[model samples]
Target: MTRITVLGGTGYAGRNIVRVAAERGHTVTAYSRNEPASPVEGVEYRTGDVQDPEVIRAAVTGTDVVVSAVSPRGELEGTGKLRGIERRVAEEAARAGVRFGVVGGAGSLFVSEGGPRVADTPEFPDAIKPEAAELAAVLEDLQSSAAELDWFYVSPAGGFGEWAPGEATGTYRTGGDVLLVDESGESQISGADFADAVVSEIEHSEHRRERFTVAY
Candidate 1:
């Protein structure tokens, strides 16, 4: 079983990942600003703010993988603040010699080959622009990280998270930078299935230091 540490373990995405990882028999640790109301069984939970690097670094120490699922929304909304946060995590991952996998946003993905990022589209909703823009930079930094970092960024299908939590079908389609869509042209994946894809990559690095997306 792999020892994995999940930052933002209490958030919508992090909770699902923690649950799926634990169910798969991986040694999982959930770290967040506060303990979960109902912690997943067989998973260790650590309470601390991600704003503090020491707390995150200590969590990264002695772990095979670090899953960064931190959300830059709500109280920390609409800011390009996660760049520093992700850099700090990258720093610790490099120091501890652990593989890093992050649950990235869909905004950074290209709508076309050259450089038409999703965030650049006129139709892209204004509500999520801040979070998307912030996390997009996080993905950019990961892509250009040092060769020995052993990191990967996985962006979920557009209809992800608590607002549109779909049921797990135990199936998902994976693709690179360009968004993945079903025959119906809907870009979505269940939270559980998204976690499954992330863990599958963690077990075997398919897109090392690169970004991939998942959809139905």
Candidate 2:
């Protein structure tokens, strides 16, 4: 089984990933600022300030894949803290020969070819723009990383988040760069399904050193 560690294990996206990975029998570890109130069984939970370099190093050292599900929000919003943490984790993962994965935002995805990004659209919320920008920067950093560093960034559909939390259908569509949408023009995916997609990537090693999106 693949050994996986999620840096923001208690967050919305990170917790789902941890649950799914553990259910799949993978050795999973979740490192977060605080311990989860309802921790997943068979998963190890680690608490620490991600700003510490030693914590990042320890989280990346032995895992086969290290996923960063942290987002820029709360105290981290507008601080550019998530980007810095992700960059350091990426560096540590590379040094340790572990695959790096980032759970990114849909803001960076193109609404159409060679055009404005989702975050750039007039209808997008201004408050979320900063978070999206930081996540986009994380993707850029991964793209420019060394060739030996295997990494993948995943941007979920536009309607993703705790507000929706759609049920897993065990099915979803995947795309690159462009945002995936249904015929109704709705772009969304369940947290469970998104976690499934991530674990599938971990097991299959598809889309190496690239970014991919998920939607219904």
Candidate 3:
């Protein structure tokens, strides 16, 4: 079984991943700012601050993969701070010979080949621009600054997150940075299916050191 560590383990994506990985018989440890309301069975939950490098190192050191599902909200606000957390975790994972996998945003994805990123789309809203832009910077930094690390940034389709809260079909489609849409022309994936894709990739190692997306 792969020993996996998840940062922001109580958050939506992290919590789901922790549950999925644990259910699949992987050794899972969850690190977040607070304990989860309903912690997953057979999983170790660790409460800590991502800003502390020592805390991050402790979480990732002996794990086979570190899934960074941290979102820039609450105590983790600010783009620079978010970037710092990603960097610290990536550095620690690299030093410890662990893979660094990120739960990335669709904003960094491309609409067409050699085209503008989703964040730069004219139709993109200005309200959520700050968070989207920060994620875009995270992707850029991961490819440039943390290039030496074995990393995979998994970006969900456009209609992901708590707003939708769709149910899983035990199925999902994979794609590169280009946006993916279903037969109904919708860009979405259930949280459960997203977690399945992640753990499946972890087991199979199909996409290595690159960014990929998941959708219905």
Candidate 4:
């Protein structure tokens, strides 16, 4: 079983990933600013401020894979806090020879081949632009990272979030830089299924040092 650690283990995406990884028999560690309200069994829970370099180093010290499910919102919104944390994690993971994975926003994905990004669309909300931009910057940092750094960034569908938590279907479609959408033109994926796809990648090691999207 792989030893996996999630940096924002209490958040929506992180919690689902922690649950799925533990259920799959991996030794999982959930690290966040606060302990989870409902902790998962067989998983270690760690509470610490990710702003501390030591905390980031500790999180990546021994894990085979380190995933950052942190979002650029709240105190982190527009502050580049999440981006710095991701960079630190990436550096630590690289030094320790651990695979790095980031759960990014859909705003960075291209709407079509050789076209505008989702964040550039007029329909995208102005309020969320800051958060999206920060995430997009995180992706850019990963892309320019050293070749030895094994990393992957995942952008979920446009409709993803706690506001509309979809159910798990044990199925999902994956794509490259372009965003994936359903036949109805709806871009969405269940939180559980998205977590499944992340763990599946962790197990299979596909899409290395690149970005991928998930949808129904």
Q: Residue-wise lDDT of candidate 3 within 1-216, one digit each (tens)? A: 999999988888888899999999999999988889998999999999988888987988788999999987777777677888898888888787888899988888888789998889998887778888777778887888555688889999999888787897997899999999877877998888999999998898888888999998
Query: Candidate 2, which segments miss by more than 4 Å at Cα?
Result: none
Tens digit per residue, CA lDDT, model 2, 43-159: 999999888999999999888999999888876777568888898988888888999999999999999999899999999999889898999999998999999899999999999
CA lDDT scores, all candidates in order = 0.87, 0.93, 0.87, 0.93
Per-model TM values vs. the true structure: 0.95, 0.98, 0.95, 0.98
What is candidate 2's local distance difference test score? 0.93
Pairwise TM-score winner, candidates 2 and 3:
2
Clashing pairs in 3: none
> Could you tell me the lDDT of residue 197 within candidate 4?
95
lDDT per residue for candidate 4 within 36-150, as digits (tens), equals: 8999999999999888999999999889999999887776666678889899999999999999999999999999999999999999999989888999999999999999999
Q: Write one digit per residue (lDDT tens) for candidate 1, span 170-194.
A: 9999999988878887889888999
Better lDDT candidate (2, 3): 2
lDDT of 2 at 123: 94
Candidate 3 runs further than 4 Å off: 145-148
Model 4 regions lying over 4 Å from their true place: none
